[model samples]
Target: MSITPTPRILVLGASGLIGRFVTDDLRQRGCDVVGVARRFSGGQRVSPDDLELPVMAMEASALAELIRARDIGVIVNCLGVLQDGPGSDTGAVHRDFVVRLLSAIRQSRRDVRLIHISIPGNETHDRTAFSTTKREAERLIAASGNPHAILRPGFVIAPSAYGGSAMIRALAALPFELPEKERARPLQPVAVEDIATTIAWLAARPLDDETTKAVTWDIMQPEPVTLGDVIDRFRVAFGTAPQPRITLPKLLLDAGALAGDLISRLGWMSPMRSTAVAELRRGVSGDPQGWISATGIVPKRMSEVVGARGASIQDKWFARLYLVKALMIASLVLFWLVSGFIALVISFPATTAILTSRGWPEAFAVPFAAITSMMDMSIGVLIAFRCTAATGLVAGILLSVGYMAGCAILTPDLWREPLGALVKTGPAIVLMLVALLTLDNR
Candidate 1:
């Protein structure tokens, strides 16, 4: 008896919300799956089975070698960025990477089936750089003359939350509603499971299966839903009573988007970026009949996906703290930045006088205060940036401890000062620890 070989599937960006689910689902179905992601760091735990590679920077030849070496039969590209920032480029990630992947497939002389995940919109509706680059990628993939399937999923809802889903959950947990205009926009959602199943179905088909090849289908539930409906479903899952919700103003939402953009440059992928706001305004909608008929996937609706059993304690905690986390980080940044700036720039003489009056040598006290203030400022700067936030938090905790210890020995009277300046460091340190603990987006 001959055994049919299970094709090896390569999932790019396997650490992402959708990619991780797809990778796990495919492996469960008995297919050999190789998950590749650009280094997984911080709290976003890396799977021992997944490979860490800067795939976006890899050349076509290098990608070809990886494909051939892994004996990969299908490539699922789930890699994407919400906006352009320090380490993320919309054009490079969406279009340039796909171009090289297609080239690599051809170079390997393998019949690799490319499954490209894209946004739900055509050129006319492509407003932001994110959408423009995504549309270009689709065009490139279709014209590549390779066997491929483009799956454009709408407002994807997965068990694990990140980006827009995280924002929605946060909103639902709050005692507020988006303005009626914003709430009424279409937000047709599809379960991440359906997307994984679609990929698996295509993978299981024969190479000559013409139906799955070169097709671009929007994979979503047949019936459309409003943003308000999705939020209400989450509210139901959370067991929250329907009360008069304080509607958020448009001006506030726009300002939040501006703040989100600033945060993005610091390395954090905030879901409230201008691009996300614009997309939210435009709403998500696409014809799912073609994908339904092709893959026979009955996508789960928002209610089914959120579940009727109600949210777990962990879910409630996460939803409530989602926005708080941002505030905590911001406060910490300002606490350090402003304090340091004042000490180093505005109150340099007063800052130096503290140590000097404590019976310290003038020469030693001057440099000591200056250096420490600069260190404080550095910690604040580090915490402000997403990439270095962890290091900054750690440094902050340690330096804070050092300051308290040093103060107790050198200037014990300062602790009992009316302002309780030294005493407050304890809570600040605790906040830093909390920020570090909750930093992971995945």
Candidate 2:
């Protein structure tokens, strides 16, 4: 009796929300899984132990070499980028990277099966950057002559939040009324675990001649629900009271998108971008019968999954704390920027007078005030970014302590003011610490 060899699989973007789940699921099923990413940081949402394979660089040559060395039989590309960031191009990730990877695979002469996770609307005439790039990549894969299964999923609901999922959870948790336009937007939320399981199942199946002809499947839940309905379901799951809906003018949404675009230019991820809003306007959903027929796995309803998961106290805490963390970070940014602006432009005379009153020379006072203001603004900018937030928090703590001590010795009376200017540092320091604790590379 001869034993069939286990298929060696390589999973790209293994640190992301869906990738992490897919990698972990495949590993648990006793498959040899190799996970690759741009970088492997300890601070990713997924714990280090969950990743079976040590994360490697996403370079084409390196990845190809690894595949050859491992004798990989399947390639599951969980890689995707929702928005572009510094040094990370959306077009490159969605289209160019895949092209290079396919070329590398062909050079290796390995008849590896390709499983790609894509979004819906890519097949239509949608001209959005996200949809267009995805469609281009799909076209490249189809023409590559590799055995591929392209799965287009709707809104993937995971326990952890990022990008649009995070935005949905945050908005749902709001105690006030929500925009009516958002309430009417339709969505078919699919569980991340189900998607992961589906990918793992596909990886295990043999690639027959007929199956190798580049098939596409729309993977989503059978039941379709509106955006507002999902929000209410999440609120109930999180042990929160559902708020009433308020119909706001479309102009407000446009203005919000404009603000979101401005923020995106500053290298921050904003969910209210015009493109994102347009995607929401055009519902996210698809037929699930094809996926079911192929995999024989029926996706669970959104409400049932959330209800079961939300029974845990920890889940509720996470749901609530996610928004709290955002608010805390926002507060720190506002405080530091406002304080810096006042010192640099509005309160320069008052600042100089105070410094000179403490027996400091006029020349030193002017330069010191200017330098301090700049430093304050720098801290605000640093804290606003994910990569530099930790450093910013540390700088903020040191500066806060130094300023408090200096104020005590130089201008002790300010501590007793009605507004408690010096006393406010107590809360500010605590807020910075909270923000630091919640910082992640995502």
For model 1, give the 10-residue run with minimal summed lDDT.
Answer: 40-49
Q: TM-score of predicted model 1? A: 0.95
- Write one digit per residue (lDDT tens) for candidate 1, span 1-442: 9655657899999989999889888888888899988866454444556898989889999999999999989999999998898888999999999889999999998889999999996579889999999999999999997889998999999888998999999999989889999999998999999999999888877778777778999988879799999999999888774756788999999999999999888888899999999999999998999988877778887778875678999999999999999999999999899999999999999998988888999999999988999999999999999879999999999999999999999999999999999999999999999999998887
- Which lDDT tens digits does candidate 2 get at residues 117-230? 888753575657777888888989989888898889888888777767877776556664456776877788889888888777777667775753478988888887888888
Off by over 4 Å in 1: 1-5, 41-49
Instruction: Choose the strongest candidate by lDDT.
Output: 1
Best by TM-score: 1
* Cα lDDT for residue 246, candidate 2: 52
Candidate 1 local Cα displacement, residue 96, angstroms: 1.4
